[model samples]
Target: MPAATRHLARRFGASQIALNTKMTIETIYIARHVDIYASSAGYRMNWVTDDWQSVTGLPRDPPLAEYGLSQAQELADYFLSLPEEERPTIMLSSPYYRCLQTAVPTAQKLGLPLYVEHGLSEWYSPVAPGTGLHPRPASAAELRTYFPEIDESWQSIYYPSRKGEDVEQVHDRANGFLRALIPYIEHKFGGKHKRVLLVSHAATVIALTHELIGDRNLPLRVGCCTLTELQRKPGETELIGAWERKRLADGSHLKDGATREWGLEDIIVINDTGLPGTENAADSPVGLQVDLLPPEVLAHV
Candidate 1:
């Protein structure tokens, strides 16, 4: 066993003798990919316009724009600022160029292996038949060449396509990803809190939240570089499956408390989506509040 696993095993042995049961607390953090912009084509709804053929007339997989790269750098800094133990031990990212780009700086800074997961890719949108608006991700070989640190040992199950997935499918995909972690969690750090970081698209992360909590009552839409955390114990009953929501679509860490810097902007507003202020207008400036609720409130949810 590796040094870290050996240490965890020794600790787990002692804890097992005292408690006589596995605790298996694993914390998962999901972050949405940061800002991306069109090269020559204009964007729509924050994504590169699907009909690039009409505008730029060039096939493109949009990478992070300059602003997006800055946001990602800020995000990396946020994670770097955390205590060593508080940072994630493992990092998984969507195979998309943008998601991989988002994870690259953090992986480089933290010395963590980056895993490309196809299930974490952006929600696909099926275009009209023969319109050729269907977007596809770059090949793994291309990604590997670009991101030399990526773990090429793992195989991706998602193939690039224009077909879009519904909310339920996204939820199922998230569940699959989560469920597959149980064995690794048990073996790597039994009964200890090990943070796993996932860099994915907005819809996939939101669906993950729903899967973990069994509720669609998310506080707001997930935005670029937003972070949400959830925790649970392995082999625990679903009835007592507790999770904590630390942050929701928050980029405040990018700016000083008093002044918004780092090119922070409120592009999407959360309202009438069963959040606390349902009556608030969709364009309300107050924007989506991160759920920094007390532990008791999180436990109840």
Candidate 2:
């Protein structure tokens, strides 16, 4: 019944996003950004916030670590190895350096358009500085300078406050984001562009799964750079279930078994300009900033 209503809306023009006339999306990939953990304290990882600030000389948004970049490249390699129709038609990222960076390799390899989405940003926390559960994002201008491929006029739909949004709020936001975005994808590029890739944070990705699977806080765990697949066929009301959960794909291309874990003692101090404590903690600027494109991608760019 619910699936029927969704299809009816797609068939007719009753929804805000008009359908793409003849398109049907076979798969959707929602992923968490590659690793950003640089140093850890008690309960949280510092997100290596200052490392990117020093590198770009921009605002304080955490960038990908050396390992993280390789993970993204691996992901690009995975996608590139896939059949043409399987690649993402459009790519989107959270309004964070890590997520944006994760998208860079694939976006470049595929020559796909990348958009920054505010709703996809990491969970916010107004809690004190010491806690590791929250994130502070870079401004749009700063991000634009680094990632010129992003549409210039794009604005964030999710606005964060000093005290970050809680679990329920994030869950609700993820639900709303998918509800609006799925229809838009079907309407905008139904036939030609059916696959959509979203690079986001851990909590946000989990929330999205909750919304799609109709479960609250499902125990699904997403590793860094993990890819989760969901399918919405033509007349299905809540995404085909039973077999759907059984079919969810996570981190299939990832060859690395264990992710990098950091401790405070391993941290380095790059310089005064670097984040206060994380001086040389992550890879040098040479590695972090450079994108060593694969041979095939060089032809396009």
Candidate 3:
């Protein structure tokens, strides 16, 4: 089949059918990691954060950057890549200066109003000046010590650990946003753009992915400016997933001696068509036959 035909079939529609596992998802979550920094040789600064362990359970500190305005500018530039109408979809951010600063670029990118939502903000950190989150190393191991690939960092960002909600809680939160936003996008811009870019912190991004695709340990590292493209089948009752990721150029993790690469398998959507005890038709697109990625086979290098 020709490339164009195949691509069309990958997206869900009343008549469209995904041809293979290499399906094209319709949604993309373009996440922005906070605390942008520049490495010694002009590499993008990443991993540095305003969330010191005191408030955040992270093991390491975010990189120190001259400022995050430039990073935000770049985000805006990407949005500007789209026509004015396309950028009006959805642009949400945290209340924090860094997060708001981070979102400015995307807001600029889409020319959409930045609707700040405290619900989607980073995890809560009770570690007061006198108190602290256990001094820990800023590595995957430390993060995993809490729960496999799942950690408090994600919990705090998504749920705030305030009153209720568990793994399912955050999933519902993300799902709620998606359910409402999907219609909003279609109404505002029609089909020109169904893509919704969420400019948020790292843990929040990872957690949101976990919500859509049923994998808590998904190896998705939403570093500074990492774009996760998810193409959902149109009119399909389920989320048939497809995507890929690369390190953000000039992002901070590269400067921290971090050696990483895409483990292609990590890019996949969970097949949640009729799974028991999960989000049903009411909450999600019902009867949606999603081509999913098994969590075990999904990993990143």
Candidate 4:
């Protein structure tokens, strides 16, 4: 056994004997990828008038915008500023170009290999019959050319379907990945007491959060480069322990707070339809209230 494993084994033995000591805890941090240069037509950044095909050649994979580069740096700095013990020992990122780009700086700073996990990849929304082809993210070998920090030896726990997944399917994917991932981490690191950082897309972030907390109805805020922290104590017989959300899509570390925040409602609509913000405006009471009030009354109220 490795030195860390031997040491952890001794500690576990001691804890078992005592029966009252606290078990080790693990911390998981999920971060959304920085702003993409472009996405689907309605979801593209304000300045990106060109289509994803025109800019990236790929249908849905666009590299981060210039400002996103700066945001990545800020994320790196934030991680670096954390105390040594609080820092993540392992880092994982989606195989997508944008996610890989977002994780590179932090991986370099921490001197950790970036593991490309397909399970953490962006949500695959269904492609309309004539709209276009579903995006196939670059393979690990292809991505290595751009990000040398990628750990080619590491394999993903699970891969997302190309056909696309509904909200519930994505949630199940996240849960399944977590079930396998916890054991993998324990074996690789010699214990479940590890800090892990995962960088993925907005939809994947929400899915992961929902799985971790065991709640889908709670409003989740996922924004560009936002961080969500989850922690759990070691469970005796369970592959995974009960997790608690310490932070919810927090972007306080960034100079500019969360931008382009998205929620479960937004993703569901986007997945069902190619367009974003398609919900009927009349359904909202705020809009109806404004329309019902006179101009003078609305101005003051």
The TM-scores of all predictions, comma-separated, are: 0.63, 0.66, 0.47, 0.74
Better of 1 and 4 by TM-score: 4
How far residue 71's Cα lies from its native spot in candidate 4, in Å, is 0.7
Which regions of candidate 1 are displaced past 4 Å?
A: 1-25, 36-60, 126-139, 157-162, 182-193, 233-242, 256-301
Q: What's the TM for model 3?
A: 0.47
Top candidate by TM-score: 4
Q: Which ten residues in a row have the lowest lDDT in candidate 3?
A: 292-301
Which candidate do you rate higher for TM-score, 1 or 2?
A: 2
**TM-score, ranked from best to worst:** 4, 2, 1, 3
Which 10-residue window of candidate 1 scores lowest in summed lDDT? Answer: 256-265
Q: Taking the tens digit of each residue's C-alpha lDDT, what string does model 1 give over 1-301?
A: 3353344447555333232234454677888877644322222223644433322121344566666676678778889999997888888888777788889999988888888766577764333333333344554565787789798765553333343444555555566555434333444444454678889877777767777666665545765676777776446544233465666556566542111111112222211112232222232211111132212112212
Q: What is the lDDT of residue 8 in candidate 2?
A: 48
> What is the TM-score of candidate 4?
0.74
- The Cα local distance difference test for each model comes to 0.57, 0.59, 0.42, 0.69
| Model 3 lDDT, residue 73, Cα | 64
Error at 297, model 1, angstroms? 31
Number of clashing pairs per prediction, in order: 0, 13, 27, 0
Q: All candidates: CA RMSD in angstroms?
A: 13.7, 12.1, 14.8, 15.9
